[model samples]
Target: MTPTERPAGIVVVLAFAGITASLMQTLVVPLLGDLPRLLDTSASNATWVVTATLLAGSVATTVIGRLGDLYGKRRMLLVCSVPLVAGSVVCALAGSLVTMIVGRALQGIGMGIVPLGISALRDLLPPERLGSAIALISSSLGIGGALGLPLAAVVAENSSWRALFWGAAVLSAVVALLVWLLVPPTSPGAVGKFDFVGAGILGVGLICLLLAVSKGADWGWTSGTTLGLGAAAVVVLPAWGCWELRTRYPLVDMRVTARPQVLVTNIASIALGLSMYAQALILPQLLQLPGSTGHGLDQSMLEMGLWMAPAGIVMMLLSPVGARLSDARGPKVTLVVGSLVLALGYGSSVVLLGSPWTVMLVSAVCAMGVGLAYGAMPALIMAGVPETDTAAANSFNTLMRSIGTSVSAAMVGVVLSQMTVERGGVLVPSEGAFRTGMLIGCGLALVAAAVAAAIPVRSARRTSDHGVAAAERSAASVS
Candidate 1:
């Protein structure tokens, strides 16, 4: 395992770990309808099962990624796995809503795996392979979600719901073992005290913002609680930014992030996040709603999951293509192309929404764009930041995407909630609402392309060759 030797096993192990962590996000989808009954809780309380994971993941990804940069990516990756395993076991045995939420929160903490894995690849892989490796790893976020739904749906349909958690626990344990065995130990990062205060301030702000977004519909969009949280986030996040800039060894380096390349990439990332999630929110509903509603396909949860699973495979398969594009034309160009593809996918949805198969095609096309865009983000971010700051920088980028998704949830939620048609005494999202959501997604994707196009290209002299050597040397030592 010299610097010259390629450790393909590390790529596989890290990608598997990332996919396992992401699967947790969608693992509970099939159980959503049954959750209240199983936990003997009210529907409103049951939603906490999902919300807890969202909040915990949003907070943990940034914190854990920074910790990985400060400590060791391999070390923190292993640490994240413990929570996933333990959380799965807790969920397996849980008989109450409170316990389920607790389990989900624990599972959310493992969401750091994707960012940490991407960062680790920079340290562990050869430069030639780095792009594809990052692409595959980043795309795992969507890959796992797409695959998990159908698998979880089938499992939940035919077996005990506890089996999902049990399966997850087993998979997590395997990931932990594989990482411990295959991932090379790296040198500790920047020699400075952890920024506890900075982490805390950022955490609180994110929690408030995400909570407001995720729960706003349930809580009443104009309610005092939502407005209060929104206002607090507006204030606290800026305060956190100021604190990060002033603090030594900050959790995230604002100076580096503020660079035009990094800043615009992140801005585009938010738009891509919004675009990616709009389909997730819209397609399943369209598939599951009663066909008598005209626009609805009336598929079962399992059927809908099956329809969506191929998109995950398509995303994984497209990762290498994205990597090639990044290597050929730069990640900036790759990102712009990806954004256009995403817009095309949503546009196709306008006409393809009629059948399950056509909708699947639309999803696959969108996923291809996600595969391309998700991969380029890390490439773009890494190119701008130094080696020591890689994990934290990437983590912040991951956080930006999460923020985008949260906003998408709120936006689409408003539309679907407002434009509804009555079907058999129940209100369902009208065809018009679904179409509007798709159009919004299309427009946002185009916006993302514009932002990406605006990012300035770097000169060869400004790019750091030392960073690349350091990463190779680090990988060589452990190998």
Candidate 2:
């Protein structure tokens, strides 16, 4: 059926694809402690299983998003599924750390599905139906991450850990089938020779920057390896900017991205990403820490995940509400409100960390803000960019969030590692560390609100009107 005839089906399939791709982010979390034993590798080597996925996903999201715009979003969506399925199968069969890391990296390449699917919504859905669909798909990253933890924990507790990857393989295969059947093909949005040089340079720069941020704590913040990667990123990224501006066809259009509306929205996105991830890092440990620490709730991984799963549900339920707020008051207002709510959530955590129930309340409140902010971000991005650049632009915005979360992980790690209490001769994060992390999140969320408030209202309205007109025209053509 044509997209116009089955827009709901298209949205459902694409959102499912997005959720499946995001599931990879937390699929192995339940096995993190067991990884060293499972792969018969050192603890440090086992960490590569997680780091490889983060690095691979960060690079692939932008590249694949551009590819989707250059080719067909539907075609690229299908292409993305292939690696997800293959990676899951490989991970299921992996008996070594290298093999598992390779599989995880391959799965990370599929992370483009979310943004690609979001860009596709602009092409396939009526403008009226667009906001809610985009919101749902955009929030699927958190939704999957939230829900995957409990699901993975359960499987890890009851069955062989390989079953987790095996299940992922089946789910990915299903997503591929559903997309092939339900998603309508879209014409290439932009025409140009792919910028191989720009992609390579940006990839190197991102790897350097993200590697430094993600591994800095483990490598020692001032260690030569960390400092060298940080220095390389500092040098390489600006060079990449110069190359992008000078190249005939750039991987990312620097000129367009520098617009005040897009620029500010991306800045807010980074802060929101950092704020959103801080809670994710802090709360689980807070819940799972032993009761002897005075602040620990003493929950098992499964129990902790179940308590946190409500946050995912809150994000899902709030997607349409956020869309309506955007429809009524504008996406900017929605973004601002979301940021404030995020800050409030974190602020409450200062007093709420004493119990699992209270901690869940904090996570749910933050998830509400994340749902609102995440939905509005792409709307602001798509409004600022031309229809032809939607996929690449959205991908870049997603990359900004990834960067924020990476930094968040590093910063929180530093705090938790340093502010520790001795428990049974082992150092565990002190209560002060958890409170400090939440306060940092609270500060970043306020910063996000300020940045979102700074987005030019006039430019946003003008570009949004143009984007809506373009979408209506595209829908009309399809009909």
In candidate 1, how many Å is residue 396 off?
0.4
In terms of TM-score, the best-performing candidate is: 2
The TM-score measured for candidate 2 stands at: 0.97
Quantify all predictions' global Cα lDDT against the true fold.
0.89, 0.90
- Writing each residue's lDDT as its tens digit, candidate 1 over 414-475 gives 99999999999999999999999999999999999999999875532221123333433443
TM-scores, in order shown? Answer: 0.96, 0.97
- Over the full model, what C-alpha lDDT does candidate 2 score relative to the true structure? 0.90
Model 1: weakest 10-residue lDDT segment is 459-468
lDDT of 2 by residue, 1-479 (tens): 56688988998898889889999999999899999999999888888999999999999999998899899999999999999999999999999998999999999999999999999998898777888888899999989999999999999999999999999999999999999988988999898989999999999999999999998988988999999999999999999999999998888889878977789999999999888899999999999999998889999999999999999999989999988888777788889999999999999987888899999999999999999999989888887777778899999999999999999999999999999999999999999999999999999999999999999753334222234445334433432
Task: Supply the global lDDT for candidate 1.
Answer: 0.89
